[model samples]
Target chain A: MRAHNLALVLDTVATSADPPSRASVAAATGLTRATVSALVDDLIAGGLLTELDPPPRTGAGRPAAGLALTSAGPAGLGCEINVDYLAACVVDLTGTVRQHLVEHADQRPAAAAAALAALGRLAARARLAAEADGLVMAGAALAVPGLVSAGTVLDAPNLGWRDVDASALLRGVPELADLPVVVDNEANLAALGELRVPGAEQTFLYVSGEIGIGAGLVIDGELYRGVRGWSGEIGHVTIYPDGRPCRCGATGCLEQYAGQEALAAGEPRAAAALGIALSAAVNLLDVPVVVLGGAYATYFDRLRDGIEAELRRRVLTAGLAPVTLRAARLGTNAAVRGAADAVVREVRDDPAAWLRRVG
Target chain B: MRAHNLALVLDTVATSADPPSRASVAAATGLTRATVSALVDDLIAGGLLTELDPPPRTGAGRPAAGLALTSAGPAGLGCEINVDYLAACVVDLTGTVRQHLVEHADQRPAAAAAALAALGRLAARARLAAEADGLVMAGAALAVPGLVSAGTVLDAPNLGWRDVDASALLRGVPELADLPVVVDNEANLAALGELRVPGAEQTFLYVSGEIGIGAGLVIDGELYRGVRGWSGEIGHVTIYPDGRPCRCGATGCLEQYAGQEALAAGEPRAAAALGIALSAAVNLLDVPVVVLGGAYATYFDRLRDGIEAELRRRVLTAGLAPVTLRAARLGTNAAVRGAADAVVREVRDDPAAWLRRVG
Candidate 1:
C-alpha cells in the first residue's frame, strides 16, 4: 500500500510538466518536507529519476536542483490486437511513446493465430525502436477486442476467438516471454487510458464502438468491474424486449437496437442508443458524464438530442446536469492509448509484486 | 460519528443480555485493550455509559468490570405520517424502541394538520410512558409522503399538499420545537431502518408501497441520494412510454404499470415494466440484493419468478451473480425504524454543528 502511495507520488511529480522541485512536490502532496525528501531519495536511488540543472539563483539565495526521469532503463511495451490489425507502442516511465509499429491481418477466423503472430512482430519492432533509443523494453501489454476475464479471452465474435487462453498465448511470444504481458478487454483499457488523461476524473460511462459495442464504467474514482467482470455489456441489455433478434439470441438487445451497423443505417446517432441505454444506468448511479468512441463518434453530432432527452427523464426536478458527450479525442487509436496506460500501471506495480511471484 | 460508534459498541455487546467488560469490547471491535479503554472512558465522561459489578471471570485472569448504557441522556425518535394515519416511536441510541404510538386522521386536505396535532398528543402520552421508566427523549424524527425538496414539500398528491414547508409547519408543535426533528421521505427512512438491522449490510433495493410506489437503494453500505435528492422515484420513470398517461403527465410509469390498483385489477404482472425499472437501477449500482416492503411485500412473493425472468432478459447474464430478493423483516414499521436512525445520526454529528445558532 505504501509502495502504491509512493508510486502515486512519483506519477504526480513526473506528470507535472511544469517540472517539480522538492518544495513543489511537498506542497502538491501535502506531505512533510522530510517525507518528500525520503521518497525522492528512494526514487533517485532506484534510477527512475535524476538530478537536473540547478535553477538560476536570482538573488543571494541557495540554488535548487531539479529532478527529471531518466531515458535509461527498461521501458514498457503496449500492444493492441484487433481482428483486422495489430499495433504496439513502447513508452518511457514519463509516458512518452518512444516507439510504435503496426501490422494488418487477413479478415478470417482461420487467421487469428497469424494475427497474434503479427502482433508479436509489431511488439518486436517497437522493442527494437526503444533499444535504438537506448531504452530496454521492460514489459509488454496486450489488448484485445473480446470478453476478457482475468487475462483470458473468453469470446470475441468479431475476432472469431473462443476459449482462447490469452495469457498463455501471449506468454509464448518470444519477446514477451521474458517480458511480462498484461492482457485486458480493449474497452476497459481504453477507459483507463481516458481516465488517466489530465482532467477526466468524475464518474462517467465509456462506450467503445468498433465491430461491437462494449462499455466500461468508472464510479466515484474506481472502475466497477461488477460481479462477473462484465457489468458493462451495454451492448446486450434489452433496449426493446421484443424489437429485433440478436446473435446472442436476445430480442431487441441494445446491440441489435444500437450496434455500429444499426446506428450506421438508422435515423439517429450511436449516442442516442447509448443515451437511451444509459438513461437507466445514469439514473441508477447518478453518473453525469458519457464519453463516446469508435464508430459512434461519426453519428454523435447527430444523436445528441436523443441522448439528452433520455438523460432528462432520469434526473430530478432540477433537470440533468450538462454531461460531456465529447468524441474520443484520440479517435481509432484509443485501444493503443489504453495499452500505454496499462504499461504505466505495470511499471508502477511491477517492481515489487512482480518480484514476489513467478509462474 | 462517535456516538453511533459507541452505540454500536454497546448494542453489539448488549446482545448477550450481559454487561460488556473491557475485554469483551476489545474482542467485539477488534480494537486493542488501550483503545477500547480510551473509548470506554470517553463514553463514561459523556454520561452515556456506566460500570457494573464485575462479571465472573471465564479464563485465568482477574475479574473484569462490566459496562452498560446509562439510564439518562438523549435517544432516538421516529414518526411516519401517512395519508390517513400517523405512527411515532421513541428508541434508544441502541435502537431499542421503548415507546410506540399511533393516531388516525380525518380524510381531508386540512385533516393532516389535525392528524399532526393528534400525533403530538400521542407523543406526549408516549413521553409520559417513558417518564414512568425514567427515560427522557432527546429529539424527534418525521417522515412524510411527498416529493420533498430542500425542506419543502414540493407535492404530496395524496395529502393535498403543494409547496408546503413541512419543517416550518411541524415547528408549531412545542414538544418537538426545541428538539431536533429530522424529516425525509418514508421510503428513504425505511431503507435506513432496515440497514440498521443486524446483518442487513448486504446491498438491497427497498420497495415501499403505501400511497405510492417508492424505492430506496442501499449500495455498498451507503445510501445513494442521487443527483437531486429525488432519485429512486421508480413510480415516475416511464415503463411503456406509449401506454397510459400518468398523473405526472408521463406515459407508462412503473407505478402505472405495477401499482397496487393495477395489481388488484388483475393486470397480468407486467414483469417487463418492473424488471426494466429495476434493471436500470441495478445496472448503474451493480448491487446484488432487493427487499420488498409495505403493501408491496404481500405480493412480491407471487411476482418473484416473473420479476427475476424479466430481470434476466435485461440485467442478469449467464454468469453474472443474481441479486437476492427478500421481504423486509420490520414489515410496515420500517419508516418508524428509519426515524430512529435519523435521530441517531443527528446526535452523532459534531454537536456544535447541530446546536441552533444563537442570536
Candidate 2:
C-alpha cells in the first residue's frame, strides 16, 4: 500500500499541468492529508520529486509549497538502429531530452555486430552527458526495424538480419553492459512516442516509412502488439497482386512501391500504393486516425492527397466519418525518444523498484 | 457484492466440465463455505442453476450435491437478415438450440419493411416453440450484413440498406414488441458463435463470406469493434488496384473477386483474390487463426490451398509460426446461433437482471 501510494503521488505530480500543493493532491487522490504528506516526503527523499519555492505571502495563512518531478533524478537511455542511421537520447523524469546524438551511415551493408557497436558508442556518449548534468541512468531500450522477441531480432529483411541476439551483443559493449536493456520494434516505439503528442487520440495507426515500411497499432492508449509480438507488417500487404517483387519472398508488396528507396528512385505510384495498403488496414481495423512517421513525415505534403483520395474511395465508412490523417510531430526522433520515455515511465509507475535498487 | 458473487457462482457452474459442489466452488474462489452456499442458493432460486443429483456414495460421510446451469430458464432469440435468406433461433441457458427456422428468398428486391416483417413472423414461431418448452425469452439480437450502431443499420451495400432503424422495425412487430432488441454486423456475431468451439484460441479472425465478405477480429476473447462500430469491412479491401469494378464504387475490391456472386459466376480467380486480401488482414492484425464461416465454410476444401499459399508467401512471421486455418464448426448457422448466444451470455453474466425482471 505504501509503495502504491508513493507511485500515485509521484505520477500525480508528473502529470499535473501546474505544480499542486499537498492539500490539492490529497483532494485529487481521495487520500488523507497526512498520508499524502508522508508519501510526498518519501518521494522527495528518494529524489523522485522536489518541492517548489512557495509564493510570496498574500492575505491568507502560510502558503503551501507546490510539488514537482525532479529534473536531476533517474533518467532513461534510448537507442535506435535503423537501416541508414544510429541514434541515442537521454530523457529525464521531467520529460526533458537532456542529450541526443546521431550518426548517418548505410547499416544494411555492415555486420549486425558492427552496427550495434556503433550504437553502443553513441549511447555511451549520451549517457555520459546526462550523468554530467546530475542525472542517474535507470535502464536502456533499443528500437530496431524488424520483428523483435525475447531480446532477439527475428528478422529485418531491409538490414539482411535474421535470428540475431541483439541483447547479448549489446551487453558485450562496456558502456551498455551495466544497464538493463530491452529490444522493441522501431514502429511500435515511435507510436508510443506519438502517444505523448498534445491532444493525440487514444487509438490510431502509426506508419513508419523508411528503407522499409512498418506500422504500429495503438489501441486504447496502449500499443497492440499482436500474438507472438509480430504485428503491423503493413509494408507486406499486397497492393497490386502482380506488380513488383519484394525481398520477403512476395510479389506486389506495399514496400516495393512506397518504401523510402522506391520514393527516392522516383516511383510515381508510391503514394497511390501506400493509399491502397492503408485502405486495407483501415477497413479491417477501423482505426480512426493514421499518422505518417519516419520518412513519410518529410513527404507528408506530397503524399497526403493520394492517400486520402484512395481512402475516400475504398474505406467502407468514408461517407459516415473521414479517417483523420496527420504527420508525426516527433518525426525521425520518435522511436529514440519513445524508447527513452518508456524507461522513464517504468520509474514513474513503480518508484519503489527504483528506491530498492538505489538502496 | 451479492450480485457479483451470484454471477461468479453461476459462471463457475456453467463452465465446469463436471458438476461441482458448493464446497468445491468455495475452495476455488477462496470464499467461506457459508457464503458460497448462500450465493449458490440465490442463483438456484433465480432459476439460473440447479442442484444435480448426487453421485452414488461409497465411503464418504455425505455426498455433496453438485450444481449445474438450468436448461429451462431464460432463453435468447437470434435473427439474421442476409441477402437471400432470413433465419431465427432460440437458445436456452444450457447453450442448446431449442427452436430454429429458416426461409430462403432473395431479399434484395423486397422492400426493407416487407423483409423485416417476414423475419418477425419466423422469430415469433421460434419464440412460441421455446415458450412451450418452459423457456422465457430474455432478449433478442438481430444480425445484418452491414454497419450497425445504436440499433441503426448504417449501410449494407448488398441489401441496399442505409440508415435503417432496425430496433424500431423489429419493435413494430407485435410478437417482438415487448423484448429488447439490438442490431449488429453478422460477421461480428458469427465470430462470437465460433468462440464456443472446443479448443478455440482466445484471438482469431473470422471471415464471413457471403454476397459480401466481412471479417470479425476477436482479441483476448472479446470482439474488437472499431472506433465507430463499423469495422471488419474486408470485402472493400483492394485485391487489385485496377481489376474489376465493384458496386461500392471502388475498383478491384475483394468482394468483386471473392464474394459468392463472383464464385457463382465462375470467376476462376476467386480463391487467389481471397488469398491476397486475407494476407493483408493477417499481416496487419497478426491473428494466429482464421476461421472460414458463412459461404466459405461450404467450399473450404477448394479454397484452403490457394489461401494458404498466399499467407505463407505474404505473412512476415509465417516462417517463425504458421497461421492456423480452419472451417467454421457451426457452418451456416453460426450467425443466428451467435446472435442468440450473445443474449444468453448477457443473462448468464448478470442473472440479477433476469431476477429483477421476473419479479
Instruction: Provide DockQ values for all models, in the order shown.
Output: 0.28, 0.86
Put down candidate 2 lDDT per residue, A34-132, tens digits, no spaces. Answer: 999988887888889999999999978999999999999999999999998999999999888999999999998889999998899899999999999
- Model 2, residue A260: distance off in Å is 0.4
For residues B1-359, write the lDDT of model 2, one tens digit per residue: 87787788888888888899998899888889999998888778877888988889978598988899988889999999999899999999998999999999999998788889889989999999899998989999999999998999998899998889988887788999999998999999999999976677889999999999898999999999988887799999999888788888889999999999988887889889988888898889888999999999998998999999988998888998998999999998899999999999999989887888886
C-alpha TM-scores of all predictions? 0.82, 0.97
DockQ of 2: 0.86
Candidate 2 has an interface RMSD (Å) of 0.7
| Model 2, residue A248: C-alpha shift (Å) | 0.6
Q: Give the best candidate by TM-score.
A: 2
Q: Clashing residue pairs in candidate 2, if any? A: none
> DockQ score for model 1, please?
0.28
Candidate number achieving the greatest DockQ relative to the actual structure: 2
Which residue segments of model 2 deviate by more than 4 Å? A58-62, B32-34, B53-64
- Candidate 2 residue A177 C-alpha distance from true site, Å: 1.4
